[model samples]
Target chain A: MSTTKKAHTTPPYELIYWPTIPGRGEFIRLVFEATGTPYTDIANETKDGISAVLALKDETATTSGDGNPPAFAPPALKIPGQGKDGKALVIYQTPSILAYLGNKLNFAGTDEAEKHYILSHTLTALDLNNETHDTHHPIASQLYYEDQKPEALRKATDFRESRLPKFFGFFERVLKGNEEGGGKFLVGGKLSYADTTLWHVLDGLKFAFPKELAAREKEFPALFGSFYGSVKEVSGLKEYLASDRRLQYSQGVFRYYPELDRQ
Target chain B: MSTTKKAHTTPPYELIYWPTIPGRGEFIRLVFEATGTPYTDIANETKDGISAVLALKDETATTSGDGNPPAFAPPALKIPGQGKDGKALVIYQTPSILAYLGNKLNFAGTDEAEKHYILSHTLTALDLNNETHDTHHPIASQLYYEDQKPEALRKATDFRESRLPKFFGFFERVLKGNEEGGGKFLVGGKLSYADTTLWHVLDGLKFAFPKELAAREKEFPALFGSFYGSVKEVSGLKEYLASDRRLQYSQGVFRYYPELDRQ
Candidate 1:
């Protein structure tokens, strides 16, 4: 295991994730891309993707004197100058990572309450994401979609009819209730990470549950506009989505399991 | 609604959660307890507990200009301060609240990465908590555990045999591979909210899946030891637990559905 050289200039920290899966990692990547940060996507190729992912899971690598197995799995970020011996600090968990990045890019918010507001919205977006994943893998992530097809059907029925509407309604309420921002973004007037995350979540849900999301989106025009509307107007985000940087969904958190969707 | 008085001393923030349920609120409550901070727990039996919770969650109140709804749920911390109109700042979301307290108390770690390390571990704890909930209500939270009893049984089988061990094992590795404090705590040498959280997670699993957790604890003795050991030694925790502040797990995230636990 040759050590990767840390960029003297910080060089936007290295991101190690599965190349094929656009699951939670996309949240981090989207932030980097949206901010035009220079980040190296080390595992965006199949040849070494699995190995890179497995290395974290490997006992030898994990048990080595590294910092607590990179704080629990991917989408781990390796900051250049933070750990002992200058070893990169690798932290996982999508919402935490998003919050950290939000703090870094000054999108988290100003006060303690607003920061908590951003976090609350972030957690809500994640709750929606988890429900979307459960729609397909309701039984267990250990089992394939085929193995849990029946369970997925029952789960998706509930998710589409209940959870989807509930979460979408919450987001809609957040937008509509945003007296601070005139019903624009998830938080205050600015475009925080929660807004970006909500956009991705909406995109993922729409891709996975087209009919249901489309029907629900009408009530959340501001939310839809935030993503498909004003967000598209951002040059960096527009450029990133059009470029190779924006990885498509293949094996990520929100996969397109057709059997789980409404006809 | 009558306005309440705010504390001037800013002693640790007051955490109001269900006394018996280790639900969403325990994360914040535990951090406060572990840190030996001066705080209050308005658990289930408090004279105004139910009404206080109800008023916070009231749709009318949510739309009103009251302190941002405490992250829209419980496990909220009423940081003693004045809002725009001399109101207290209510911070919500279990992870967000924990992170806020961790930063305030100095357990969140020394840098951006460490703060994130704590954040990731907290999120993982939440994921584990969610899985425990799902084992009983595998399909959806909207459906009662009784309604999904059949699926819950099957899911708990997987949870006990595979998921619990896998997640517990991961934490064991995390504790053992801790380079900073020689694997003593989750991150650094001192105890973190993550460690406190891990203690509660394992304890809840034990209560819910005693037979399974008992058998598995032997393999991960250090993890179990650190959890039970570290928490027991925390200054205020034992008193808090005995004094009715420590919630019993009845209505929280990791509820014990007996049918799911049975073979």
Candidate 2:
């Protein structure tokens, strides 16, 4: 209930993730940036702050402290004064973090029904992100892409031919289906975190599979045209995109490998 | 607000998913069964019920009627008279459906913080389920496992050696950390959907990688011992597991290929 704290309020939010490469942390960041809300990117902004993230993934630790369980991975959020007895609340999973902040910042939706729809769409978009990551590391996340090159090549081919069209068509239908949203949004008329999250994934796709995305752009006009392009112009996003804070895509969830792309 | 309806209500929830396998749909079914709540499994119960599922994923249609967007896949839940203007509310995505049912069935948690944690844990369990599936079809979901057998063996090796322990250790720590849960629940003192969702994943893992799981079971006592053994005895789960309603795992996310298992 302490999350009643509005967007611009005190108790600065802390995002715990890897220091760079825009990884899964970027999904959490886009929601914050798109709402113009101030948050501390703990691992990126503060030196030695990544210790907080390391502790989150600490294998020996039983709990995350302040009555929270240890995170299975990074991209966790810590909100001060929001836990039991008014301690800090820590939550992980990119969609879960987005849901918590989206509701607080009014990017969730108009009502409970809209809220779940937005979360569902955000989750679907994240599924695409994970599949994209698998294209480069099909064999094992612990193994480098070079070691898994043969398998990665096969996975990337299926991803470009079948998976990409399936996901793109679904989102395109969602956009066209929502009368209020027209072609610019996935849920309701306004820019919910679903739109923000999907936009970032699309941007990452362009970066990771430029040739494939370029070839398929005209197929899903709603997704690649209006919904994809106009999202960058959304209120707080325009400035963030032009700023240094919008980290470039490298070897995170998305990576650009020429051989992995359309030949 | 419509979800204010509690368990054992008159709504008679309808679950839309493919019949014959405990796929992602089983996550939704567990919360319903765990609470002794009644729900109709559309594709399984009725003779011509697949029409509803087909309509949900109609690729040509932009909207899924009754003001709902088309689902990206099966395993969608429909709550009649729960949407805008009192229409059937349809939602997809395993975790999203589980959260909705868990809350309605009183299996979510006691407070807002617990609710998010439970959902986050459920997502992690589902992530493990997904990785298990990828091991068999390392190259493409559309491709036959035999065609990808070489890659499957390699991926399965990494999964058994690395990923399984990481997930098992994390959940073990979670069970031990929550003093109130005492290795019986993942969140608070009560049985939650997170517990049910995780219990199923562990069950599937045992089926998929029996040799590997047996080898590693002793390493994480909290998980393989108390937590795994006790959840089956949860109020409604015991009866549900005994009944014919519970489908056997076949060619779903968790598949048993001796060649893919630890040898």
- Candidate with top DockQ is 2
Q: How many pairs of residues collide in model 2?
A: 0
- For model 1 the TM-score comes to 0.90
On residues A212-241, what C-alpha lDDT tens digit does candidate 1 reach at each position?
A: 777777876767765457765565678777
How well does candidate 1 score on lDDT at residue A76?
75
Off by over 4 Å in 2: A1-10, B1-10
How would the docking of model 2 be graded?
high
The lDDT leader among the candidates is 2
Looking at candidate 2 chain B, the ten consecutive residues that score lowest on lDDT are B1-10
Give the top-scoring candidate (TM-score): 2
> What DockQ does candidate 1 score?
0.51
Clashes of each: 7, 0
Q: Which consecutive 10 residues in model 1 chain B have the weakest lDDT in total?
A: B1-10
What value does the lDDT take at residue A30 in candidate 1? 77
